[model samples]
Structure formats: structure tokens, C-alpha cells
Target chain A: EDQVTQSPEALRLQEGESSSLNCSYTVSGLRGLFWYRQDPGKGPEFLFTLYSAGEEKEKERLKATLTKKESFLHITAPKPEDSATYLCAVQAVSRGYNKLIFGAGTRLAVHP
Target chain B: GAGVSQSPSNKVTEKGKDVELRCDPISGHTALYWYRQSLGQGLEFLIYFQGNSAPDKSGLPSDRFSAERTGGSVSTLTIQRTQQEDSAVYLCASSFGMQETQYFGPGTRLLVL
Candidate 1:
């Protein structure tokens, strides 16, 4: 079965501290890996999409890198505004035209 | 340029009642999707509409859940005989095509009392 798992369910960091969130997946064939940031009570906001291994994309302080079996979202010197649930999802080729399998997001809290 | 939009930002209904959620995708988008998200959980794919066709209804959890897209624009997701387990945020998303990046709307929060 195609599935995605995100680790470090919750993380608390002081302002300026940085960390990485993990998303591991097993799919029939990887079409794309996506990262999103969601604030409470709102839909996820698209962040980055990595289409292949060794692929990386960045926006603001978030950088996403993809591998054959997993993806990593690395946060650079974070701030309080960067505090939000980071979600990871994957689109499998077999399920290519249909849906996205999402991971239970990582709740990140950065305190100033 | 508006993104996707959903009706009834919040809905509260008694158990066994029926409810309808609506989604208006960005103009010209060819694909739309509906997803359910339980509190503090990941989003679950419910259904999707490509143009006027829905080739996959297998993502829907039960027969009680149904969706339709009209004129290749707006979409509606209806839940019949709502149960407490049906309480969740129903989110709508759209993309230029089935394989493109999806843009989501602020979800409708549904509460089954």
C-alpha cells in the first residue's frame, strides 16, 4: 500500500533555532512529493514540490529535498512566524491522476 | 484572481441529518478535489472531478458520501445521514490539471452533534 509517515509529531524550538522534519513514504511509483504549511483552522498552503531524487526547492526559510524513499524539510534559522504544522504528501504514478496521500504533519512551535 | 472557495465556512447539524458542502474552484481549472481532515490529523482524499468525469470514487469512505461537479466549474460534496465520525473539516482544492499542483480553499468545518 502507498503510505506516508512524518516524524517528530511535535517540536518546540527557540527563535533562531533550526531543525529538520522527515517524511518517509512507500509508493508504487513516485510522481511528486509536496510540502505544505498549515495554520490552525486553515487549509494547507503549498510550499514546495520535488519531482525526483536529488531534487530540492526552497521558499523563504523552508527548503525541501527529496530522495528515492523519503523527503526532508529543513528549516533555516527559524522565527516565531515560521511556527506552523508542516505537512508532507506524495502522488504515486499508479494513483497519479487521482489523489494525494498525506502524512500526519509535524507541529512546529518556535518561541521568541 | 481568487483561489478556490467553499460555502458555509462552518456547519453544525444533528446526527442523521444531511448536509451539502460546496466548492468553487479557480476559474479555468480543469480538476477539483474534496478531502476530509479530522482534528490534528492528515487530510483524507474523498473524491475528485476532472472536467466532467470522475473516474475514481474509491477514495470515498462510504456510499453516504457523494460529490458532483457541474459545468466543469463548481462542485458539491454531500453527506447523507451524518454520524459523529463524519465531523471534520471538509476541504476543497483545485488545479490546472489532474497532475498539476493543487490550490486549496479555507475548509468548511463540519460538526455532527
Candidate 2:
């Protein structure tokens, strides 16, 4: 069974549209949850790291919130440059500290 | 400061041929990781190295895949008897000692024929 799952395999949004991406995870001894943005033919760029329920962090127009069962990446007034795949991952004590189990990702396309 | 870097941005090899992928992590980072992303799939954990401690090899898919970090810096992932199923984008990441945040490299796209 996959430990991490992401929804809306593909999402198309108009410029200035605000939305959220969901990431549900099932893991024992959750260490942390991570959000990343990946562009074509490139590695993932770090976005946010949420460590516990009710934890939230924001950068620019992006914000991440975490709870016991899931995490969300909310984008505000997104620009075309924000179009990319958003990935969510988790680390578990069982999997050790160095490995990250990633979700299939949500492909987000923002257009003007 | 530079982030993680990988060599041979792309590689094409024949089945049964051996190939080596290299990763040069951030200068002072003590933890390095290797992952593979197949077409339309998520990143798969492969192996890990932390300082001088023995690596965590549990994520390696098969014995044919092995990696070694020399002098706590550069790492090389060697795939022996590469198979078509091995084709993927190999990515490397690194973080500070025992830290949870890992920054990734651009990745090396490997294609097996």
C-alpha cells in the first residue's frame, strides 16, 4: 500500500485563482511532512515542511497546513510561473530519517 | 552557496551494460540520498549515506545497485547489469547533519536500450 496519496491528478486554474492541493498519508510514527514544487526536467524545489498537527507555514503566496491525517498546500493568486507539479512526501520513524516516501504528485497548471 | 549537483545530466546505456551516476552534495551536508523517478511515477528512495556511519541500504531495489560515498562528500551510484526497467531519472539530495530538510539536485536522466 502506498503511504502517501495526492488528489486531483491534474488541475487547471486561471490566473489569480486560489486553491488547495491535498495530501493524505498513513504512516506510523510520523516524522514530518514536506511539500515541493517540480518543473519539467528538473528536480523538486523545497516549499514547506510541516512537523505536527495544526502547524502552518507560509512563503510568498503559498501556505502549508498540516494535521494528523493530511496536509494541504494552498496557493493564492497564482501566476503562470506557479504551474508545475506539486509533490507531498512523508518521513516515518520506521523508514528511518533519511528516506522520503513521495506521492504521485498533483500537476497544477495556472494560466493567464 | 551551491545546492546539490549531479554529473552527466543524461546517460544512455545498453542492457547489461554498467553505469555510474555521481552526486556532489552541498559542501557541508552530512547526509546524502539517492532516489529514482520512473516515468509518470513518484520518486523512489534508493539509498542513504550519513557522515561516516554505514549507509542505509534497505531501500535499494536489488543487489545489483550499490553506492559509496568517499570522504563524506561525493557519492557514486553504480548500476551493474542495467536493465530496461532501470530507466529513470536518478536524483540526489542532501541536508545538514541529521536534519530533515533535503535539497535535491537537477537529476540525471538514464535511458536503457
Candidate 3:
């Protein structure tokens, strides 16, 4: 069975604080790992796609790193605007079609 | 220039009634997907349509849930004999190809009374 688990279900950080969220998964064959940010009442917005271990991607104050069994989303000097639910998902190579298995997500609050 | 779009930002219906939600993918995107999100829950895959190929409905929770894509551009999700537990946000997304990055719409908030 393919499953994704995100730790630290909720996090409260002050502005300018740095933190990291974790996403662990068990899949038959790793194809792609995705990160998304979803605000209230809106669909998730794409953030990054990590395809292999040791790969990393960054955007402004956000950086995502991948490993064989997990991924990490590191936030640097996060702003209040960065507060949202961060979702992690995985696509398995064995699935053939583009089906994504998603984690429960981590809610982040960056207060000023 | 436009992204994926879904109709009826919010819908309220009584239990046992049926409802249809619509989605319009990007101009040339060939892969369209439907998902359900309950309060504080992650996105649950419902169905996927790619070009002229058959849709994959394996993720659909029940037989009462059905979807269709016409002309490979627009899609609709219909829920029959709705129940209160069916209330959730129905989200639509599209990608250029099977493994490409997906773009999502604002989503339709369905409320069953």
C-alpha cells in the first residue's frame, strides 16, 4: 500500500522564524514528490516537484529537499503571508496513470 | 492565459438531491482530474480523464459518483442521492500531460442539508 504521512500537524511560528515540515511516504516505486500550499477556501497552489533523492528546489524563502523515504519543506524567515496548509503528495511509477496520493497536510501559522 | 475554472463557487442542496459540478481545463491541457476535500482533510482523488482515453474511476468512493469529459476540454462530476456526508469542496485540476504539473481551480463548496 502507498501511503504518505506528514508530521507536526500544526505549527505556530513568529515572523522571521525558521522551521521545517516533514513528509514521509511508502510507495512501490517513486516517481515524483510534490509540494503545494493551500489557503482557506482555495485550491492548492503548486510549489515544487522532487523526482530523485538528494534533489532540492527553492523559491524565495522556501526550500524543499528530498530523500529516499521522505521530503522536507524548510521555511526561512517566514512571513505572515506564508501561513497556509502545506500539502505533500507522491506519484508512484507503478500507477501508470497520473494519480497522486496525498498526505493529511501541515497547517502553518506565521504570526507577525 | 487562463487557468482551470470551476462553476458555482458555492452550492447548497437538500439531502437526496442530485448535483452536478463543472470544470474547464486550460486551453490545451489534456489531463483533467477531480478531487474531494472535506474540512481539514487532504484532497481525495475521484476521477481522471486524459485526452480520448477512458477515464480512471478507481478512486471514486462509491458508484453514486460519476464524471464525464466532453471534447477533452470540459468535465463534469455528478453525485446521485446526495447525503450530508457528501458535503465538501470539489476541486478540479488539469495538466498538459499525464505526469506534468497540475494547475487547480478555486473549487466548488458543496453543502448538503
Candidate 4:
């Protein structure tokens, strides 16, 4: 079975603190690794998609990196508004179609 | 809709009642998905639909939960004999296809009291 696990279930960071959230996976074939940010009542908003190992992408304060077995979402000098549950999902394209298997997610709270 | 839209932003129902949640996908999207998010479980995949083809219901929790998509657009997820365990925010998302980026809606919060 394909699985995704995110670490540090919850994270607390003071303003300007930098940290990284990990998402380890065991997938047959990786088509893409997706990152999303979700608020309390809203659905997840797309963050970044990494298609291969050693690939990195960034937007604002969030940067996503992928390895063969895992992915990391690095936050650079985060602010309170960056607080939310960050989700990690992987698409097992080897199985055909883009069926994404998602992890429970990492809740981040950045306090000022 | 400019984005995926879910109906009844908030719903409170007594246990044993049946409820229907609606999802209207973005225009021209061929793939749609439903997921549940709870305080403890986070987000879980429920079901997925692609075009007018048969849906992939593999992720549905039980027979008590069923969903149907009509005309390859709007979808309705029906829960029978809802239990307190069913309380969660049900989210809907859509993409151009299975491989495209998915855009999500403001979820429908269902509280089974």
C-alpha cells in the first residue's frame, strides 16, 4: 500500500523563526508530490508540486524540496499569517490516473 | 462558478437523520473529488469522479455513505443514518483532469449532534 507520513504533527514558531516540515512516503512510482495550506474552515489551497528528487520550488516564505523517499516544506522567517495546517500528498501515477494519497498534515502555529 | 462551490456552508443535524451535500465544480473541469476533515483525522479521501465515466468509490467509508455525480458536473454526497462520528468538514475539489492542479472550495461543515 502507498503511504504518506508527515512529521512533528504540530509545530509552534515565533515570528521570524524558520523551520521545515517533513513528508516521508512509500510509493510505487511518484508522479508528483503536492503541498497545500488549509485554514480552519476552508479547503486546502495549492502550494507547490515537486515532480522529482532534488527538485525545489519556492513561493513567498514557503519552499518545497523533494527527495527519492521524502519531501520537505521549508518555511523562511514565517509570520502569524503563515500559520495553518500544511498538507502533503503524493500521486501514484504508476497505478494510472492521478489518484493522490494524502497524509494527516502538520499543523503550524506562528505566533508574533 | 469561479471556483469549486459547496452548498450549506454549515449544517447541524440530529443523529439518525440523512443529509445531502452538494458540490459544483469549476467550469470545464473533468475531475472532482470529495474529502473529509475532522479534528483528529485530518483530511481523508472519500470518492472521486472523472467526466461522465464511472466513479472511483473505493475510498468511501461504508455503505452508509454514497455519492452521485450528474451530467458530469454537479455532485451530491448522501449520508444515511448519520452518526456523531460523521461530524467533519466535507471538502470538494476539481481539476482539469486527474493530473492537473486541483482547486478547492470552502468546505461544508457538517455537525451531527
Candidate 5:
């Protein structure tokens, strides 16, 4: 079975603190890995998509890197505004359509 | 351009009552998806529609859940005989293609009492 697991269920960091969230996945064939940020009572906002191992992408203060069995979301100098639940999902090549298997997510809090 | 949109930001209902949620995909998006998110949980895939193909409903939790995409633009999710466990945020997403990045709507919060 394909599964995704995110580590560190919750984290608290002071403003400007840098950290990384981990997502490990098991799939028949890796197709893509996605990162999303979700605010309270809001849907997830797309962050980045990594297709192959060793691939990385960035936006603003966030960077995402993918490997054979895991992916990491790096937050640099995070601000309170960046506090949100980070979600990681994986798309398997064996799936007929674009179905994504998602992890439980990691809740992050940045304090000033 | 406007992103995906869902109707009725919040809904309160009694158990056994039926509820319907709506979603409008992006202007030219050919793929639309529906998911359920519980408090402190990740997204649970519910259904998906791509162009004129048959919707993928494998993720629906029960037979009472059904969805339809009309004209490949707007989609509706209907839950029959809602249960307290059915309460959650229903999210809608749309993309240019099946493999493309999906943009999500604000989501509809459902509470069954």
C-alpha cells in the first residue's frame, strides 16, 4: 500500500528560526511530491512540486527537496505569518489518474 | 484569474438530513477534485473529474456520498442521510490537467448535529 508519513506532529519556533519538516513516503512508483501550507479554517495553498529524487524547489522563505523515499520542507527565517499546517502528498505512477496520497501533516507555530 | 470556488462557507444540519455542496473550477481547468478534511487531519480524497471521463469515486467513504460534474465546469457533492461523523471541511480543487498543480478553494464547513 502507498502511504505518506510526516514527522514532528507539531513544532514551535521563535520568529526568524529556521527548521525543516520531513515527509516519508512509500509508493509503487514515485511520480510527484507536493507541499502545501494551510491556515486555520482554510484550504491548503500549493507550495511546491518535486518530480524526481534530488529535485528541489523554492518560493520566498520556503524550500522543498525530494529524495528516493523522503522529502523535506525547509523554512528559512520564518515569520509568524508563515505559521500554518504544512502538508505533504505523493502521486504514484501506478495510479490511473492524478490521485494523491497525503500525510497527516505537521503543525508549525512561529512566535514573535 | 479567479481560483476554484465553493458555495456555502458553512452548513449546520441535523443527523439524517441530506446536504449538497457546490464547486466551480477555474475558467479553463479540465480537472476537478473533491476532498474532505477533518480537524487536525490531512486531506482525504473523495472524488475526481477529468474532462469528459468518468469521475473517480474510489475514495468516497460510503455509498451515500455521490458527486457530479456538469459540463466539466461546476461540480456538486451530495451526502445522503448525513451522520455526525460526516462533518468536516469539503475542499474543491481544479487544475489544467490531471498531473498539473491543483488550486484549492476556501472550502465548505459542514457540521452535523
Candidate 6:
């Protein structure tokens, strides 16, 4: 079974559109939840990390929130450049030092 | 100071050939990692390096896969007699310490044809 699952495998939106991507995880012990943005032909870039439920972080048009069982990445008034695959990962406590289990990311396309 | 940097951004080699990918982490970082991402697939942890201690090679898929870190900075992941299944984007990242946020480099995309 997939440890992590992301919904809406692909999404297309017009410029200034707002939407949210969901990431659900089932792990032995969730040490942290991470959100990343990846561009074509490039490595994934870190965006935020939430450790506890009800925790949230924001940067520009991107905001990530975490619950006990899932996490949400909300993009508000997104621009065309915001188009990219958004990845969610979990750091299991049993796995130490930079080891991460990632989900098949959501491919987001923003049209102008 | 610059972020993590990887070399040979793209490589295409015949099956059974050897390939080497390099990663130079930011100055003063103590943790380094390697991950593989196939097309339409999520990232797969390959290895981890922390300080000068023995590396965590548990994530390595096979004996043909191995990596090394020198001076606790730059790292190299080598695939011996690579198979078609080894083709993927190999990503490297460095962090200040264990459990810290990691900064990634633009990965090396390897295609074993």
C-alpha cells in the first residue's frame, strides 16, 4: 500500500485562481510533514514543514496546514509561475536523518 | 554562500555502463542525502551522510548502488553496471543537522538506455 496519497493528480487553473491540494498519510510515527514545489527538469524545492496538528506556515501565495491525518497546501491568488508539481512527504520517526517518503505529486498548471 | 549544486545535470548511458553523479553541499552543512525519482513517481531515499560518521546505506536498492562523501562536504553516487531500472532523477540535499530542513540541488537526470 502507498504510505502517502495525494489527490487531484492534476489540476488546471486560470491566473489568480485559488485552490487547495490534499495529502493524506499513514505512518508509524509522523515526525514531520513537508511540502515541496518541483519544476520540470529540476529537483524538488522545500516550501514548509509542519510538525504538529493545527500547525501552519505561509510564504507568498502558498500556505501549508497540517492535521492529525492529513495536510493541505493552499495556494491563494496563484500566478502562472506557480504552476508546478507540488509534493508532500512524511518523515517517520523511525527513519532518521534526511530520509523521506514522498507521494506522487499533484501536477498543477496555471494558465494566464 | 550558494545552495547545494549537482553536476552532470543530465546523463544518458547504455545499460551495464557505470555512471557517477556529484553533489556539492553548502558550506558548513552537516547532513547530505541522495534520492531517486522516476517519471510520474515519488522520490525514493537512497542514502544519507551525517558529519564523518558511517553513512546510512539502508535505503540503497542494491549492492550495485553506492555513495561516498569526502571532507564531509561533496558527495558522489556511483551506479555500477547500471540497469534500465536505475534510470531516474538523482537528487541531493544538505541540511544543517539531523531533523533539520534540507536544501536541495537541481538533480542529475540519468537515463540508462
TM-score of each: 0.98, 0.97, 0.98, 0.95, 0.97, 0.96
Off by over 4 Å in 5: none
Q: Better model by DockQ, 3 or 4?
A: 3
Evaluate every candidate with DockQ and list the scores: 0.80, 0.86, 0.78, 0.69, 0.73, 0.81
Q: Which lDDT value does model 4 have at B5? A: 94
Q: What is the TM-score of chain A alone in each candidate?
A: 0.97, 0.97, 0.98, 0.97, 0.97, 0.95
Angstrom error of the Cα, residue A67, model 6: value is 0.4
**lDDT tens digits, residues B1-35, model 4?**
49899998999999999999999999999999998
lDDT of 4 by residue, A3-78 (tens): 8999989999999999999999998888889999988878899999899999999999999999999999999999
The interface root-mean-square deviation of each model, in the order shown, is: 0.9, 0.8, 1.0, 1.4, 1.2, 1.2
For candidate 3, give the DockQ. Answer: 0.78
Clashes of each: 0, 0, 0, 0, 0, 0
Question: What are the clashing pairs of model 5?
Answer: none
Candidate 6's displacement at residue B96, Å, is 0.5
**Candidate 1 overall Cα lDDT vs. reference?**
0.93
TM-score of chain B of each: 0.98, 0.96, 0.97, 0.95, 0.97, 0.96
CAPRI rating of model 2 = high
- Stretches off by above 4 angstroms in model 3 are none
Give the alpha-carbon lDDT of every model.
Answer: 0.93, 0.93, 0.93, 0.91, 0.92, 0.91
TM-score for chain B in model 2: 0.96
- lDDT of each residue in B76-99, candidate 2, tens digit only: 999999999999999999999655
Query: Rank order by DockQ, top first?
Result: 2, 6, 1, 3, 5, 4
Model 3 pairs whose backbones collide: none
| DockQ leader | 2
Poorest lDDT segment (10 consecutive residues) of candidate 3 chain A: A93-102
Candidate 3 C-alpha error for residue A108, in Å: 0.4
Residues A16-37 of candidate 2: C-alpha lDDT, one tens digit per residue: 9999999999998889999999
